[model samples]
Target: MIVFDKVTKHYGSHKALDDVSFSIRPREFVILVGPSGAGKTTLIKLLLCEEKPTFGRITIDDKDIHLLKDRYIPYYRRQIGVVFQDFKLLPNQTVAENVAFAMEVSGKPDNEITKEVMKILELVGLKDKASNFPRELSGGEIQRVAIARALVFQPKFLIADEPTGNLDPVTAWDITKLLLKINSLGTTVLLATHNREIVDNINKRVINMDKGRVVRDRRRGKYDYK
Candidate 1:
């Protein structure tokens, strides 16, 4: 479980997040929706430990994340998988290598790395593109590779930030279905997106934010924004 206890973040004199509080239970799929500069990104940063909260506490699985030492931050981060709007892949590496690189950096054995890479590629429906490079694939395919890379470690939580922003509507829907599939298989998903169509269609838990504060939180909620 993830808990945010009155979390607040400040940048200079500006408050990016204002006493935000929420809890995400295990295996629950939740959407974080808000307009630009509404603190969505800041909240994610705090969760990832990229930035510390100026006030409040964040706990994951009962451990206070902010109290973790610098040496333990990397290990803490490995517990959550993150995907972004931009597909960040190595131009020089093939799809298989790109996925395997995550395990490689963590010093996993070659045999285990290969096995896990193949499994994750198959999970993301991109096993056939294993040998292909990023430049040879379409935008959707690139995002699939990114998702596979994020899942290679088999993290308990997945954070997707505008994952379908760069794709067409059809491709975006496909990606959304893929995320739903993953969530159904028991990975807790926190999707931060501005796409109302996806949010309303999914109809899961919705937490709406505005001006750095949570305005509404509902189960099976719709996107109530312009």
Candidate 2:
């Protein structure tokens, strides 16, 4: 469902991504694993259109991303969900409001918005915290809220960058299981993380990067840095 065709990105003279190419099929759970400065974040940013590729194409469900018009960006984004290292929850809004806000801005019907919000909250196991603000929740709970918001639209593809970075090992594993569950439900997941134990334990497909290129790609893999 997603393809990176010879994608390259450079920050001035320093290349952040160098001709990286890969394809992710529907429902595939793929992990992008690498040390810091390995261009994993660069890859995610390019997919999100937060950064344009210096060369090559990125296609999602066959549509070339860079070719899309500015007005239609949201339409494209609605097909994908993203979670970041920091749970980007609104401080003032309650959990339900945070999830509902995405639908609201997209002009969804009020009833539909309400339904989706409730459904996703339940999916992420945060239904009871709907009325609570971000500050009122624990790190894990806040992250769950972030996941719910990301899944509210039932996106075809999910991108998570360092999703378990701030949590304890046990909490990290819980979040990992959540991602696995989401993948099992047929949403493609692309995770960029440094958590070696989680990556090793999951035993999923791993794509290791170094400098700016994919150094290895393994299926049902262990953590083998060399």
Per-residue C-alpha lDDT of model 1 across residues 119-144, encoded as one tens digit per residue = 89998889999999999999999999
Q: Model 2 over residues 1-226: C-alpha lDDT tens digits?
A: 8899999999999999999998998899999999889999999988888888999999988989989888888878877799999988889999999999888878999999988898899888888989999999988888888888888888889999999999999888889999999999989999989998988888899999999999898888655674
In candidate 2, which residue ranges exceed 4 Å CA deviation?
A: none
lDDT of each: 0.92, 0.90
What's the distance in Å from true for residue 119, model 1?
A: 1.4
Clash count, candidate 1: 0
